[model samples]
Target: MLPRVLAIAGSDSGGGAGIQADIKTITLLGAYAATAVTAITVQNSLGVAAVHLVPPDIVAAQVRAVLTDIGADAVKIGMLGHDATIDAVADALADFAGPVVLDPVMVAKGGAFLLAPEAVGLLSARLLPMAAVVTPNVPELEALAGTQVEDEADLLLAAQELLESGARAVLAKGGHLPGDGDEVVDWLASHEGNRRFASPRMATRHTHGTGCTLASAVAAGLAKGLPLERAVAEARAYVAGALAHAPGLGAGHGPLGHGWTLASG
Candidate 1:
């Protein structure tokens, strides 16, 4: 049977991120893809112009319909437009037995807000409890932890604060950290301890959906029964390959070649 990964996210008109990226990443990784769209955006590689939110009940219904039938081996949650959507999504996944990966998508790359500030607290309260892993970049990590993460030291401290939110693990991505170094490091904080995954930075602007791709790739790995550490490792490697093979499409941040993994590595 094919591993199923249900991605709960917004729809990107540009197909660079959100449901589009999730489905592409999951499918390229040899997993089945499902989605519960929370919003629709008039967005492209350049920026997001407008957003139209879907009803919370409707989003929940999609979740119920997919999970109750096809069944997901793992769930990757991306954007929740507001508190209502967060609550609805949480309620829908209340009884799901699979691992859940939460990507706290607060804003789009083009400076558009996807998650309302008020809803952050609701997500921390309602959804964090059920998530096996929460993936946040430097900005989202700072927002969720309510502190300045200047370096790994500050990030570890802030990640400690998020651990109180009931999530089993938090992967604090350091992609935006200020440094002239040629490499980036991501920290994973869990009950066991902290581990670092570092990679040489690739000079490229085709990283519009890097976060979405990474989260979905991790979900795909989890859906295939890979352990957390191994999943993260594979996801990082996969994203690196995608970045390396980025097609450089679009005027702004270009979309990655998600099919790169399927090509000869």
Candidate 2:
């Protein structure tokens, strides 16, 4: 049987991030994808222009409807635009008996703020505890930890702090750090242990939805019964492959080549 995974996230009109990316990544990994959109974004490869939040009740209804019927083996969450949306999602997932992958999507690829400032507290208090794994880039990590993470050592500290904050596990992305080398390292820390997944960073501006893709891929692996460490390793390889074969599109950061495996097959 195919593993069923649900994505509770925003909709990206550009089809590169949010629900779109989650769907693509999940399906690419041989999982059945379902979605409950919490918001709609007017965006493109260049940037996000505006966001229209979905009503909290509607969000709850969608989640309940999906859980009642199709049922999820895992859930991938991204881009909750407000405190209310965060609260609604947390409430909806309170009883979910599946792995939950949380991508702390505070900003867009073009530097647009996707999450409200007030939502941070709600996320920390209500949502973090429910996550099987919380993935955050450097800026999001800093926002969550209330400190500056200057180097790899700081990243490890930040991951531990976030775990202390509430997350069961944390994946601290190292893409935004200033470095002269072509390598990027992401740390995965959990109660079990800690490990780093590093890759030669692709020298392309076409990484609009890498975070979403990575988180969803992890969720897919978990849905398929892989342990957390193995899942993270597989997800890292998937993202690296996608980045390496990015389909050059748009005038700015472009979408990843989610169909790379299909081509290879």
Compared with the true structure, what per-residue lDDT tens digits does model 1 show for residues 1-265?
9999999999998888999999999999999999999999998889999999999999999999999899999999999999999999999999999999999999888888999998888998898878889999988999898899888678777787899767799988888888767988898889888888999999888889999999999999999999999999999999999999988889998888899866775
Off by over 4 Å in 1: none
- Checking candidate 2 for backbone clashes, the offending pairs are none
Give the per-residue lDDT of model 2 (tens digit) for 121-217: 8898998998999999999999998889888889989999998888899999999987766899899999888998888977899998999999999
Give the C-alpha lDDT of model 2. Answer: 0.92
TM-score of each: 0.98, 0.98
Name the best candidate (by TM-score).
Answer: 2
What is the lDDT for 9 in model 1? Answer: 96
Relative to the true structure, how large is the alpha-carbon lDDT of every model? 0.92, 0.92
